[model samples]
Target: MMGLRGINRIVIAVRNLEAAKKLYADMLGATFHDAHWTGAPFGIHVSIAWDAGIELCAPMPGREHDSAVSQFLAHKGEGIVTVFFGVDDADVAVSRAISAGYACFHSLDYSQDEMDQHLGGRFCRYQESYVSSADRCGFGVALARIDRKPG
Candidate 1:
């Protein structure tokens, strides 16, 4: 990616997806997309779009493992984990990230739940990465191009 975009999505690593969704959607004026069972060991993923769609991905509750998301909560103490970017080629973008020494979080299978949940019918595809640096605010998340609202 030549020019990177602003912070597109703020992924919150929370234990309670429903609680997070309630707070964000009801109190914080966040318009939620839809929830999905990621098929990962994790329980459910709720896509909440306020100004941006922040994916609230939580572990399946119990059956804890030394996974990256687990480490994220252990280290950063919840909030924003990964930053997504919509690039021309995910493979090429991933290659560039590899060259830049950035750890890439591979693409999610596919979720159309968001469109089904939202009243306005907004949709988007998110790709992200996490760069570790103990000194710089614990860690840093960067989002590239956020392709949304469809063509």
Candidate 2:
């Protein structure tokens, strides 16, 4: 069985990233540790507060009219868009989740080297799988297999 760890991270889609960041900071006293242009294949900006397990995402101006973030914000307003869970094995976790009635939208695997660069030198291999929102209470759920021992 895949070892299912607890909540890994949460991604909130917002219309304005900075405003959302400030709101969260004011409410939770959380500081964002990193900011990046995410939505790689698409277009969006993301701010991450790793300590608080929060990721705030917003559409890039003029470039995101058709991006998923923009569509989500247009439909749902600012709200939780995705949640991630830490797992020992992404394949097994995804299989289990599918058996439990969840539908996987897609999955990806990242080697240690790729992840290191993506994470700014945090070296770890991992696999990630996304379960569609339609299958999980109208919010996307993702499983991540991080190369780390559970504490």
Name the candidate that leads on TM-score.
2
What CA root-mean-square deviation does each model show from the true structure?
4.5, 2.6
**lDDT digits (tens) for residues 1-151 of candidate 2:** 7888999889998888788889989999887855563464567787887668898888878756776688788877888889999988788898898898888887888766666666655436677898875444788898987664234
**Model 1: which ten-residue window has the lowest total lDDT?**
126-135
Candidate 2 ranges with C-alpha deviation above 4 Å: 33-38, 148-151
For each candidate, what TM-score against the reference?
A: 0.62, 0.83
Candidate 1 per-residue lDDT over residues 1-151, each given as its tens digit: 4454444666677767678778887776876765553325444355656465577766655623444467667766667765554454555656676687666554432345644454244546544434442345444555344345656
Q: Which of the numbered candidates is closest to the native, going by highest lDDT?
A: 2
Q: Report how far residue 124 has shifted in candidate 1, in Å.
A: 8.0
lDDT of 1 at 51: 67
| CA-lDDT, candidates in order | 0.56, 0.78
